[model samples]
Structures are given as C-alpha cells and as structure tokens.
Target chain A: MSETWKAFKPYALITPQTLVFLLFLVFPIVMIGVVSFWEFNGYSMTPAFTLANYQGIFTDVTLKTYLNTFKFLGLVWVATLLIGYPVAYFLAFHVPKLEWQILLFLVCTIPFWTSNIIRMISWVPLLGREGLVNQILMGIGLTQQPLEFLLYSDFAVVLGMVHLYIIFMIAPIFNSLMRIERSLITAAEDLGASGVQIFKEVILPLSAPGIAIGSIFIVTLVMGEFVTVRLMGGGQSASVGKLIQTQIGSLQYPLAAANAIVLLAVTMLIIVSILRVLDIRKEL
Target chain B: MQKRALSFYLLLAFFCLFVLFLYGPMITIFMLSLQGPDGALTFPMRGLSFYWLGQVFQEQRVGNFIEPFVRSLLLGATVMAITITASVLASMGFRQRFKGSTVIFYMTIASLIVPSILVSLGIGVVFQVMGWPTNWFSSGLGAHLTWTLPIAFLIMLGIFNRFDPSYEEAARDLGATDPKTFWEIVLPLIAPSLLGVGLLTFTLSYDEFTRTSLVSGQNNTLPLEIFGMTTNVTSPALYALGTLTTIFSASLILIAYFAYTAVVKRQRGKA
Candidate 1:
C-alpha cells in the first residue's frame, strides 16, 4: 500500500494538465463537430442543423477556388523542398564542423523570428516597381523602366512564401540527414557507388520522413494561407483563408464555419494521407 | 585535396547566399523605415531621418497598428503563463499511468499534428456560441484559452516525455507532498522546457493572425493591425511599424535557442 502511495503521490501532481487538456482541447474539438451542424448567424447561433455549407463548397466556382489555392500551395511546397533539400544536404554532409552548422542554422532561423506579415511586407520595397531591384537594374542599364509586374503578383506571393517557409522545411530535413551514419556514405563510395547514385539510393530515401514532416508543416500552413496571398497577391486572390475571413468580417458565421470546416477537412485529409505513406513511427 | 577544399568553399558560399536571402528583406525594411515616403530608393534617404518611426509613435492613426501589437504582446504573455503552467502539470501527469492514459496521450499527439487553423476554427465557432449565450465570459479569455490549452499540452507533453520520474519519486519518498515535489524537484528540472514552450506559445499566440482575426471581435492584436494597415495603401507608416516589429520578434527565437540548449545539455548529462 505504501509503495503504491509513493507512485500515487507523483501521479497526483501531474493531474492538472490532463484536466486542462480535457477541458480546453479535447472538449472544443468535440464541440466543432457539433457546431458544424448548427446554423451560426453572426450574433446568435441557431440550434438547427444543416449540411448545406459542405454541399455549397462542391459547386464549380468554389471547387475552382480550392484548386487554385492548392495549385499555388503545391508550387511553393515543391520550391521549398527543392531549395531546402540542398541546404539540409550541405549542412549535414558538407559542413565540416558542428559549430558552423549551428551558426548557419541559427542564421536561417533569424528571419523567421519576425512576424511572417512583416517578412512578406518587407519584399514590397525590394520587388516593387521603383524598388531596389528595379532601381539597380535601371541604374545598370539592364532595363528601361521599373517592372510593374514585380510586386503584388502571384510571382511575389510564391516567392515570399518559399522564402519564409524554406527554413521550416530545412530544419526537419537536416535533423533526419544528421541521423545518417557517416561511414555508410563513405562505404557507398568505397563500393564504387557514384555520388549521384548514393544520394538517390541512400540519402534521399533515408530522409523521406523528414521531408514528409516538413512538407506537411508547409502544406498545412499553406492550405490556410491568408497573409502571403492577401498581401502579395493583392487581395485579388480569393484563397480559402481569405474567403473565410470575408465571411467572418460580415458575421456570416455559418457560411464561414462551413468554409472553415471544409478547409479543416481537406487539411486533415492531407496530413493523414502523408502520415500513412511515411509511417513515421518506424523512422522515429 | 583541392577538390575537397573547393566543395567546402562552395558550401560556405551557398550558406552565405542563403542567409542573405533570409535576412535581406528585413534589412531592406529597416532601411526603408529611415527613408521618406516619396517612394524613392535614394541612397541618402532624406539623410536617414526617423520621421516615419516618429509617426508610428506620435500619430493617432498609428493606434490602428499599435493596438494589435500591444494586444498581441498581452496575448502572448498570458498564453505563455497558461501554457507553462498547464504543460508542466500535463508533463508530470503524463509520467504516470492510469486508465485511458494512452487515449489521452494520443489525443495530445493528435492535437499537435492537427492544423492550427482547423483547431482554431473549431474552437472559435464553439466559443462564439458559448460566449454569445453569456455577456461576461465568452468573448475574451474563453476564446484565447481554447487555442492556448492545446499547444501548451503538446509542448508540455514533449518535455515531460523526456523527463526522468526518479527524481520526483525520490522527493516524494523523502516526505514531500505531491505539489511540493512538483514545485521543488520536477518543476526546477523542467524549467527550461517551460521557458522554451512558453516562448514558442507566446510567439505562436502573438503572431497568430488567422485565428485571432476570426475570434477577436473588437480587440485587435498586432497581426490584425498589420492586416488592416496593409489594406490601406496610403499609410507608409506601417513599414516603420514592421521595422520595429522585426527587431522585437528576434527575442522569441533567442529565448527558444537558450531553452533548447539548456534542455539538450541536461538530456546529454543524464544520458
């Protein structure tokens, strides 16, 4: 009895967290399923249930909006992977010293500290018509006039998102790459495996879990993307996030909730699909 | 040898360029803050005046930006406190076994993977309904608590998983009460995690744009203010605020690094 009392004492100390989690997190998610059915007007929510919001999203226009948002997100997702892969590869395999790796990694994380909004906005002066790039280009006689197509375009939106999220992609990929046994790479070379073949056959496959983690991180955030698309895409882009925001602004809670629920469904589907494919438990 | 050296040099060059890409826009914003609103990229920049920076401080219109900023900070601080407290307890509780503990643990895991936006929307809708039925409770703290609890649970879970239960057990054996053992032995050991998780929660809370945008009725946080300002193209003063915000944001990352190092070091020593 005393022995069990000893364990019980420690267990009791940690119960508050379990209680709070139940009260806040687990409870609200349960409520979301409930709220999705209820008709929410701005001021007061009606208890009446409807699945019309889900049905509405399947219409051609709304589906097209989702397609466009995914298309953009996918492009940025690929770009972040392509760019971040080399940085992680170099950091893990190429960097000679541990201190340099940490220093370089810290430098990569510095910009992320700034609000993503500021990071997106900062590009305006650099990419704007009379911005630094154009001024420099014109000064060097590379162009006759400021490039009007530079800022507030899909190009800028993709560029800014890639720049902001590439770090998120790199960190996980690096963690996986660092776990690779050094002698294994050397042995591949010793066995007459070419550098490219070793990467293709060994390094790339080994790092898939990290890539999956990073991709999900980027893609899920990208799915609910508002800041980059709004600021850089000039609000002309009606992203799922922006669409939900518009509804919320006017107090269209039911419609907004409906839209948000759709986004949530799509995002959860992607994460589940990725987790299934990666089977990350084995890697961990 | 030359080939090896060349590849090393190439990697260094790429790292330098990559770091530049990460930081270049921020440096540009810093520079632009000092420039006049004539949309000129002139080198002199009207002799580097703080005219726009001053405008952010003294102008009443600046309230639009400052309100959100202050609100974000407040939200961040409050969320930090809640997350640290809750996560630490969860971490401790997590160290023990009970009925449905695995289910509870998996629930925490699920929350971590579930998209923040999804969770935010779900909670935001629920809070609105629950809060609408009440004048005193629903709107303010209730809304924030919904998001804060999930994140704090996840972070505290990660921390507690890494912690050894022996120390706490020993303290309890020596006649410490449950709360006293947590406060004296367990809490001190996990202090760094609390700080790290607290900082991350604060950053996530402060920079939380989408969820706060949905949930905040009349209350504007820093992100919402920036959102509003960006829409109004007339104001270049937002650029100044961006510059200032950039400087302030670095502290979160610094806190994160210190906390991570402390945690990692402790883990290594134990191993």
Candidate 2:
C-alpha cells in the first residue's frame, strides 16, 4: 500500500490541473482540428470528411489578409523594439538604485494589467478628427486640416498595437538586462570601449533571448489581432483574426477552424524558429 | 560622484515624454467622462459634471452594464479560486519529475500560445455540439481557465524553481510529517507568489475579451460589454464606463501589492 501510494502521489496531486488542461486546452484544440475536416452548411455542420474548408484558404482575399496581418506584425515588432529598448536600457543600467528601478518598472507595467479595450478606446479622444493631436497640429500651423490618417486607419491600428504591446517588450528586455553581470559592463568600459561599442558588443548580444521573447509576443498578438484592428482600424483594415471572426459570424465554423489551423501553423513556425535560437525555459 | 552626463538628462526628458505619451490619452478620456450633459467626445471642455458618468448606470440609455460588470467580478473570483488551488497542487507535484510531467509542461505552454479565437471557437463548437447550453460560467469559465491557468502555473514554476528546499528538509528531519512540513514550511514561504497568482488570474479573467466574446454565450463580460458600447455609443458615458473598470482593476492591483508586501515583511520578521 505504501509503495503504491508513493507511486501515485504526484499524479494524484496534479489531477485537478491536468483535468482542467485536458478538458479546456487539449480537448478544445483537438476538437478544432476535428471540426476543420467536417462539413458545414448554412444552419449546421455535419461530420462528413471534406477538404472544402481547407481549399477555401487559397482565395486572393485570404492571401491578401495574411499579407496585411504579417505587415502589421512586422511594423508593431519594429516599433515596440525601437521605442521600448531604450526605456528598458534606462531602467536596467541607468537607474541608480534597486527600489526605484522596481517602482518605476511597476509604473511601466501597471497599465498593462488594466482593461485592453479601455486602453484601445482611450486613443479616440486624442486621435479623432477634432481631437487633441489635431488641435495642437492646427494650432502650430503644421497642417490646416486634421490628418485623416490619425484615427480609424492603418496608422491608428499600428499606433494602438505599439501602445498595447510595448509592455511585453520592455518587461522581458528589462528582465534580461537585470540578469547581466554589472562587472562585465564595467570591464568593457575599463578596457577603453566607448559606450556605443560596449552596448553593441556586449549588451545587445546578451539581450537576444529577451528580444526573441518580446518579438514572439508582439508578432503573435498583432497577427491574431481582431479587437485591436476592429477598434483602432475602425473596420478599415483586414487581418487573419478578423477574417476568421467574420467566418464564424456567418456560421462558417469549418472554414474558421481551417483558418485557425493555418494561423496556428504560421505562428508556430515563427515561434519555433525563434526557439531554435534560444531555450525559453533556460532563460527564466 | 562624478558629474552626471548630458545623456542622463536627455534620457530623463525622453522618459518623461514617454510617460506622458503613455498616460495623456487615458487622462483625456477620464476627464472627458466627467463632461457635462452635452459634452462631445473630443475636447473644448463642455463644462465639468458627473452627468455623463451617471448616465452609464442608466441601462435604458446604454444597455445593461452593471450586470456584466458584477458578473465579470464573480467570474474572476471563481477562476481565482480554482487557479490558486490547482496551480499550487501542480507546482508541488512538479517538484519531482514524474510520469507525464513533460507532457503537462508543454501542454501548459501550448495553452498560452494557442490563439484566443481558437479556444473561443473550439469550446463554443464543442459545447454546442454536445447539446449543452454554453454559459458565462460553463464554457466561458473554461475558456478563461485556459488563459489564466497557464500564466499562474508558469509563475508558480518560477517561484518553485527558485525555492530553497533546505527548509522543508530541515522540517522533515525534525520529525515533522509531510503535511506538517508543507503547511509549516512551504506554504508560508510561497504565500507571496500565491498572492501574485491570485491577482493575475482575477485581473486576466476580468479583462479578457477575444476568448470570452464568442464563448460567453448569451451574456457579456465587462470587456465584452464595453466592446459592444464602442461601435454605436459615441458619448463620454463610454469613457465613464472605462474609467470605472480601470479604477476597479487598479485598486485590485494596489490591494494585491499591499498584501504581497505585508506577507514579505511578515516572513522577514519570522525569519
């Protein structure tokens, strides 16, 4: 009895979490894969094996949407990295004390915890035609008319994504930066390396895992984004996520599932490529 | 001691502008929510009052939000309970490599990586085909657990990876039983991480959108309700609702932080 009990302990302890995972995560994904092969009519679906849904993905519009979504992903990744890196650098190296570094880091991340929809909508008051940015632009004689691209355009979509997703960049980069030995940086400087050279040769290479982590986040999010494109693009943009959502809305479950599988494939392809460079488990 | 470089000042200015850039739009919306009865969505302040904020509570004007808000809070609490219990157990069980440990770890990571829409659609289809009435509590709850549980599990894993096991060994050496050792040594040591897991699960559940929109069945969560209001409702009342929900999330964060610090201080006192 004691031997059997010892053997069963870990599995028994993990039962609840494993159950939730199988029921919610693994089962649902498997069902999606199953449903992707089923046939769906206007009102309901049948369990007939059909390749019709997968064949639908070759349309020009779907290809265009995949291209558009990838474009947003690249744009947001570059913007978040360019803008968020310096902020992380400021926190990791320049901050004089640990407590202040932590406090300010919390300041950076606190907004991320709040409602994302609220954060997305918050842009409207400032980016709309009669909003503050336009008012200031007109006041300074930058332009006589409000920039139509400020809100409800691809510009707005990119801006909102950068705003929302930049947190993912800053947090991990800061984490990776915090783990770097200060002595290494000091040694580089003492060896007559310029600040730029020290950063280029030492800091940048070490932060690769962080950059990879942040890139995965930004890419996956922007690629699968429907809500951000919907709210910020204001229906002016097309995205893979939004296309899938539209399919589901029109009672096209099999088609949506097919798109989701392709989406999962593309996303996993990018992420696996990133993972080939770094072991995320080892980083944490 | 050396004179601070010009770079420091320049970086400080940039940081200030970034902070302003982060917060200015939010503040604009919050202030606009307080605009008088006739204020437009844009600026040129139409005088300040609580009229628009009050208008959010009037369901006849803005579809029912109070129920959704309250429902979201309840759902958050429910998810938090399960997440804390399950994540704690799983993390404990993970302290030793067992059968299927690798599978569970990958599944947890996969749970995080899978697109939210896939979860929403998958469960929605499963429940519909099962002849079950998908609900805010059933399928909705399951969808949310997939999002929150992996996060909580990962956090707990981080905490456990850094955990000092010497204390537990010492307790056991002192003739303490397994349950006693766990309760006396492990739980207190990990209380702060548990608090973090709690806060994360609750807030993520409360603010969830893409996953819940399709699976939440007939009713809406707070985020879904706010999303619906975005399209047609062009008033500061929407901003008022935003302000309220943001305040709710912020206060929860503040409360969690305070509790965390208190636990840390108490642990220090004991040590």
Q: Compared with the true structure, what per-residue lDDT tens digits does model 2 show for residues A66-139?
A: 99999998889889999899899888888899988998888887788899999988998899999899999999
DockQ of each: 0.47, 0.73
Candidate 2 clash pair list:
none
The TM-score that candidate 1 achieves is 0.87
TM-score of each: 0.87, 0.96
Q: After superposition, how far is residue A62 of candidate 1 from its true place, in Å?
A: 0.4
For candidate 1, the chain B TM-score comes to 0.79
Task: Tell me each candidate's RMSD, in Å, in order.
Answer: 3.7, 1.8
Whole-model lDDT per candidate: 0.72, 0.87
What is the per-residue lDDT of model 1 for residues A164-183, given as tens digits with 9 covering 90 to 100?
78988998899899999888
| Per-residue accuracy of model 1 over B55-97 as CA lDDT, tens digit each | 7876454354655566677767876786677666665566667
If you superpose only chain B onto the true chain B, what TM-score does each candidate give?
Answer: 0.79, 0.92
Give per-candidate clash totals. Answer: 4, 0
Off by over 4 Å in 1: A1-32, A38-45, B1-4, B36-44, B62-69, B131-166, B169-173, B233-236, B255-271
